[model samples]
Target: MHIPELYCPIPSSVVVKDPEAGEELIRWGADQGFFSLDSDAANLVRAIDIPLWTALAHPMLKSADDRSFLNRWWTWGAVFEMRFDTNAGQELDGFFEKFMDSTARTQIRILSNNPPLRDGEDFSEPMDRTLVSLLRETEQRFGNPWRSRISRSLLASAESGVWEARANYLSQTPDFDLYQGLRRHSYGQTYITDCAMMAMGIDAEAKFLRHPVIEHIQYLVALYGGFVNDLNSLDRDLYANNRCSSVIAYRHQYGVTLDEAIRAVVDMCNGYLRSVLAIEAAMPDYGKYSFDDQEADQIDSFFYILKMLMRGNIDWYEVSPRYNGGWKPGGPIDPAPWG
Candidate 1:
């Protein structure tokens, strides 16, 4: 399972303050099968004391559905771990429950709809029963949380927007420019809201959303994360016929080889990283926003956490089965070390 070339070593600057936290994180990953790697999966586990990562464990343990919990954590927990503190994590756990419940309600509502049929054709047949059966099974497997009708509508609308964005991209012809492609590709749920919550912890929504600089930070972080993914997912995306890649877009626009396209992407990512770092350095003294002392400190912590997150993406990419030659159906895609 090892790929020396794919490996992105953890930097000393992006560190975990507590050894126990690091061990628990690694253990949790193993228990959850976060990667298709064996016990000696340290390379797959990057150490960043993201308090939010720790916070999720409590809810996860209490969850009736381990798979659903694992899916959520496996998807975002790796990235979240790099930047958040303990209090931030706790705050996020509360938000995570709300967000997941909202998402589930949205999903349920979508599934509840009847599929459009041709004129003069009734869908009240065996398939309709089958669909209802499937829906019931899904509901039973994953219990629904109480969500207000207004909350459901809002979440559904948000989900619809993402669906529209993706559909719009797929409907378009190829040969999109880098910006267009990045916007389309990077526009999915990247937990930008949750990231901001790291600073505010509780009641963080209004402050983070209202702040002018936050949008810029969000855009940069999304682009940075998106580019990192586009770079790592070159092969998988190509194989899966997902061509909305920034690197591929660059190649189409410039007529370069894949390697050259990769280099170009790497350079762009590094540039974004530098920009974020510069922002981190300058944010403290900027004094434009009416940030209270606590808010200011949180913002500073966020920037630092962001750096680790961006870098940790590179590290996680190297080891995640999702990127490595590890994903396969109906089997342990990669064998454990003992085997």
Candidate 2:
């Protein structure tokens, strides 16, 4: 592989449990009705240990069942991308038609308003049923407010998927600067942090959500994760002819070697990590927002999950076989180059 070692600054007390977590992953999937052993989605997960990734990303989970719910929930973004972002993916227009046409009636409601699932309600399409189930479960565990906040990020995630699909549809690669903006969302950080928050079962008032410092931390978490993904997947993305990577963007815009571009991207990621740390430390008093003890705890969880997001799964990226195969006939869905 041409990828060089990346310097990730954030720390994680990651404990990737052994065969036990793997076995429990199945039971958790079965209990939640999200993952299937024989499905294409199952084929996709074989490339990397997603359950382990989920566990590593959200260490706040104290229970086995909690870890599994989040592991499966975190994997849904990939499943959605494969369904709508891959070659066999639905037409871009149809994706909007299927998912975006109704501003409030369908998924937005399921995500934000969060109506209860009836005994057999087709609240969403078959694929999205899992997401709806996950969201409802989030509401049950956390509360209507927490679920609503998570829903907002998830809506952004879906829209970001559309942005990514749009970029893929265009013959030319997205503009370097514009792509960075899109990358912040397209790479799944928004939903990743939100999923972690849901698992932690934390909530904040509207003012905290709108606070500038809080917003900046959220932005840095997403930016840092996107850079981490771009750096690690550089080899696989190059083989697949996908040039939307920030590393490639730097190299393309400036006459730099691939190695230089990789280094520059790594430096950029480190900078974001430093920024998150500084911001977390210098967080202004929330007294201005009249934050209660519960809201203050929610703010603390934000920092915790932010650290987890900024930690960037570098361990998994190094080991997980992510689409690094070249000219291979077939591969598992998780690591497959295209999706």
Candidate 3:
């Protein structure tokens, strides 16, 4: 689904000026049926510009020696940029800075609040300091001083209570078993972390959707998206991370091969797509200017683009890889049955 041309009637001009006020406005918009929780979630997801930019900016990830990986990363950024609202793009630069700072502060506080898990152990202090320093260094390297500041503040504020809640949620529920599985899988861990951060951003911004139901939906979408991307990059992820994805983990435990594993992952992703489609359909009708239609179209366009890429009809530079890793165009292959 290519992103639809529908303009979100909610004024970007007003929202972009102040994030707190913008969040309130988003909630109001949702209540009035001008938007859905998913759309609001999408906006929060878009705000994590740093991670996306990091994937683009990091030399290790974007080596000129590996043109395919660099090109694919660029393509992914382009697609996201194409779909992102212009105002949202402008707001994100600042929002990302504040967000990073917030997360950094929170991480620091959490580390300080927790005691060592073992005798004569005190890795938390040094690890927290190292992460803070790394965050600063990353921002400096990227020329984002504000991001560094915000990251420091964010991590400092994230204390034991928050950590405990997150830990409890991950440990206590079958609902979050997929997340735990992802955490256990090396390649899948990035998705879990990214989704957790995205969910936090949404909660921090729009307070109304902080409920478990909303968080669970966001987690599901993120997990399934990760599954799809992992299936698409199975060979690359294995080579780069020396670990298979959660889907592969499940397969190994149950005894399945590459092809069978791919099918299972695809089926799971398709189920997520169906759920997304249903949510988009249920959104209140907004005459000819429907946000639901716009969302549905974007989903359709993404699948269409995936189809084209699978068929090798799209230029390698035109379709981007969603996750980090190197790629070799037409290296070793299985002809996709979807083609």
Candidate 4:
């Protein structure tokens, strides 16, 4: 049984700019509980680590590496996930509410008969002023149509994760199709397209994303990602009272032992990986237009990035202590297998 190999050589250009970016991202992932060894860490780390990894691994061209979009998205994605565990609506609500409260307080001070003089006196504290300014700046930034577009895109992605999480928590029986669908969106697979486009150029994402074949390939990529996660976190998932796993779900559905369940998922993931490679190999037939050398290079780069993600995920999972150290394999079957 042959399996596709995985490895991503760091591009020299990326290394030149940020020599340690890849290593740092890997270390950050390990510490943030993506590894089995770090099982004691908060599960909420998923919100942070996944987005950050995606952002860090974004295949922006050398020229665009300095753009803040990736980092900004990573920050907001983490915040969104944290809010999911606590209160999803509160962060947005609180952002506005805090600003309004501060404004009202400032207005009241101005309307009152308070003296404007006094050496150490101020209408608002320094920290309050900073907060207000930040709020104003954030409002102004969002007013930009480009930022607004990305914000909407990210919000949609976050909503998918929220839905999938809910579904996983509620489901007891294994529904492979449902799991794949939810996993693709929940794991931020669509963002791979976005990142690839960013790497290619301004409209590159739009042009390539419009192709029906590319959409099909992207779906496979998402499945590969999700299954890799399912395999890596088998132990952690069981420990965390999580049954939203393909392996356990399969075992429940088929009444198979843990080892059999693992084998089935590995086969499923391998099939998806093979599909991705086949798409890469058949790019000429599927591409919407003929490309000159430059355009061809761009397309090749896009696929390379996608493969990098596929391989990078497996590498991260193997090395990360959060997935490896803490849990034992083949524990007692969880009685409630739906979750």
Task: Find the candidate with the highest TM-score and give its number.
Answer: 2
Identify the candidate with maximal lDDT: 2
Off by over 4 Å in 3: 1-180, 183-207, 237-241, 283-339
- TM-score to true structure, per model: 0.51, 0.78, 0.36, 0.59
What is candidate 3's CA lDDT for residue 106?
42
List pairs with backbone clashes in candidate 2: 44-333, 44-334
lDDT by residue for model 1 (1-339), tens: 111232223252333223354455555555444443343233334322233332321221322343233333333333222111111212443443463355333333434443422344433332233323333443343323211221233233334333323432343323535344334223232443232232223233436535777657755766777666666655544444444566667777788887787777777777776776677677667744566765666666555456555655565545445455563322242211100
Give the whole-model CA lDDT for all candidates, comma-separated.
Answer: 0.43, 0.63, 0.34, 0.49
RMSD of each candidate relative to the true structure: 13.4, 4.5, 18.3, 11.3
How far residue 117's Cα lies from its native spot in candidate 3, in Å, is: 19
lDDT per residue, candidate 2, 1-339, as tens digits? 355555565675657565566545555555555467766555565455676676666666788877766766656655555543434333545554454454324654565445654666774354457777777787787777776777777777666666665555553466568777866676467777766766776554546767776777778778778878787666556655565778877888887898887888877888887877776676555443455554666777788877875553666664554434422433445334223
* lDDT pick, better of 1 and 2: 2
TM-score between model 1 and native: 0.51
**Sliding window of 10 residues with minimal summed lDDT for model 1:** 80-89
What number of clashing residue pairs does each candidate have, in the order they appear?
2, 2, 20, 12
As for candidate 1, its clashing pairs are 51-85, 52-89
Residue 69 local lDDT, model 4: 35
Off by over 4 Å in 1: 1-189, 192-203, 206-209, 288-290, 325-339
**Which sequence of candidate numbers ranks them by lDDT, best first?**
2, 4, 1, 3
